[model samples]
Target: MEFHSNSTVFHCDVVGSDAHTTVLLQEAVDALAVKPGGTYVDGTFGRGGHSRLILERLEKTGRLIALDRDPAALAVAQAIDDRRFSVSHNSFSKIQEVLGQFHVDRVDGILLDLGVSSPQLEDASRGFSFRLDGLLDMRMDMSQGQTAAEWLASASEAHLEEVLRNYGEERFAKQIARAIVAARARQPMVTTHQLATLVATIVHARGRENKQNPATRTFQAIRIYLNQELENLSLALPQCVQMLNPGGRLVVISFHSLEDRIVKRFMRQLASSDGMPRKLPLRANEVRLLSRQTLRLVGKAIRPGANEVESNPRARSAVMRVAERINRT
Candidate 1:
């Protein structure tokens, strides 16, 4: 379990064999329109799913620089021995800085596969899934940041309610937050089972609309809040755009509605020129320049097909968006 990411590269045999199937794997890489000698970025190198396929498409001259917050993912990324491929242990939000570290000013393409990976969810030790019981620690990057358990222990009931309401979109946030406060007063909420069972009892009595565990929203809320998932996505999107070469692609596959909204709005806004009409006489080139449109939308948002969803239910919620950087100059 102790996978140190330093001067050594450990070849993990099971890294690619994990149960977590990369959702929209082919679709994502294809959207990149990989050029043989172009450089690319895989913002979230979860289990090296996209990274492996991307490397396959690249020629020896093509370079791919990947970034991930998870230590386990960094270890898995090391398994790739190609000289053209390199990975940095960091969040995608720091993509600009990561590029600096590699002495890369621009890239031909960038792919960001957001949300909790299957390995992170399946590994109970990581505490992503409410269905499985483990430590309440839900830090995406185990190396740093406050654990979910620690945050829950100190967070005010009001703060917890706000997180549940905003991040989870849970309707019963207030009641659940109040109950957590009451329960924690008697005993600290330290484990996944404790929090799950507590939320379930509260939700089961009031609402029974879905088959999913009643604690599902609370768990998601806590994970997203503690890990700053939405915040990171907001920060990374602009950097992804800034780092891409003209005619390069930016592909993002988001699993959460909030994440998808940010991607959708950002892409749409960039692809449009805000419909700015010239009040004064201006040439077509000048109008185009004044418009400030930086990207062209690729097809429409893509979702996993029914067959793929059937095989991997997690893929059901995936939404993939693509846009190509336009030559503004």
Candidate 2:
């Protein structure tokens, strides 16, 4: 169904004090070079931290479309009364279809604040954090798919091992997977603390260098696997490129190396022009650029400054990368 900017509504966060500070806020927004009357997208609205700012920068006619799979995130978006802003409750991977529904053929820029948001992690009911003792339900979109607990119940040992290694990049993935299988056999792994304790028992990393909890990687791996985060990101990149208007920018903030690598490779591959068909030599003016070479790499991968990281620990691992669409005249 088509949702117009004026017709769409969002719920704003009332108690924003505890909200996770949006990392690299100015840098990511500036990368867009947002024009007053241009259209933009916040691919991961997360509590509308970036979306609210984007709306502020836009002119009265300028439009901003924000998307989030989490109902809680979308609820946070419902409080904005501006006619220029619209929020959609769906995965960013469905960019093409969502844009189509809005009658938006292309946008001037797109921002993706990827990974778990603070509210999702802090809210015990959502089951996104290892620090909380909630059910193992890590579905980004609670309305659909298998919960982390459900997946753990039936997933094969090999599959679980692969997810931990591939998504979390945990060195002790094999031992952790074995531990999970063994523990589940004794009793259905239900609460966050139960799983965390079990994983900690198997993973014996010693010393003061363990800055993060032992079960952090295991929970992350399960969340990513259950929600298909990497797969969704891979699917969304090409669509993001395609959705950009000529000269439009794509800004992405990835919290982990795995997600960052995928964005980097996707942008690099699209920016290169190595696969064009060979033809009779022609003048530079006569030669045409490959359609996929529509993007040009922006500045180097950006990281949060020490001050920002100190204020918001969540910013510590965030990495932002940007690219711009080259006019294909």
Candidate 3:
């Protein structure tokens, strides 16, 4: 229940060569405006790519706290021997709770890189990619919950269609779900390739796209639903804003439109005073106190540069947004 920093990480990518390349590395770190002696949080530690960078910007007096849900990331975090840094094994949605456990009241900044990491895609056993043949297990934390295979085995055709449509935005969700139901009656939905092939069959016949894998949206849909990624993000944003010190930054890097939509709306809502009640003809100071903004939108959404996208194609979809906490004095 009380895991130390060295124990794990938040949902994020891998480190080292052949692992995840941290997206917006310089831009994200720079947005944080790291103060050598201030405290900060890397909400999604992944493989410590961002965490490591944050630590480098910190002095011995400064502190960095990190979180990740994947145990694999926990192992990577263990290698960090710095005394000023600590990590936790938990979802980013639990940021407030984790900070409490760490005895930290507020932080100067928080950075969240949302979406699948390259290590997850490359690891066949994790079942994140259709290109890789492995067990159909896409649980972000393999130890915690149901795998994609298990869900597919038990989920009804209608429910499967809903997930595909809502999460993946697949146009032919209904047909694909029907095919899955038929296929499962004959054999178990046990492997990534099996499901990928099945989905591709349906997609190829009706919803084919040449540039992308036919089953790409299907895989993404299942993973998002099963992992409850969007829900976690929704829960985490308010907490991130609440925990920031005045002028502290909240940086989020989202990989898909859905995730970005949630982030954008949340940031915009808090940054605008119109979201508050304004009926009372109260005094200026009183109105200010009652309807003060909690966040101020920073620069425009940042995307990976052309060179970065070319070198790491996965970074192409990334969109980073920044918001700074407002001092309500």
The lDDT leader among the candidates is: 3
Model 3, span 1-329: residue lDDT tens: 12464333334333433366998999999999999999999988888788888889999899998889888877787667777877787899999999988889999999999998889899999999999999999999998799999999999999999999999999999999999999999999999999999989998888466888899899999999999999999999999988999999999999999999999999988887634466666667767754667898999999999999999999999999999998643
Task: Write down the TM-score of every candidate.
Answer: 0.92, 0.90, 0.91
Q: How does candidate 1 fare on TM-score?
A: 0.92
Ten residues in sequence with the least summed lDDT for candidate 3: 9-18
Model 2 TM: 0.90
User: Candidate 2 at 118: error in angstroms?
Assistant: 0.7
lDDT of 1 at 323: 98
Instruction: Write candidate 2's Cα lDDT for 219-280 as tens digits.
Output: 88889889989999999998988889988999999999889999999989878874555665
Question: Could you report the Cα RMSD, in angstroms, for every candidate shown?
Answer: 3.4, 3.8, 3.9
Of the two candidates 1 and 2, the one with more favorable TM-score, higher being better, is 1
Q: Cα lDDT of model 2 overall? A: 0.84
> How many clashing pairs per prediction, in order?
0, 8, 6
2 against 3, candidate with superior lDDT: 3
Model 1 lowest lDDT segment of ten:
1-10
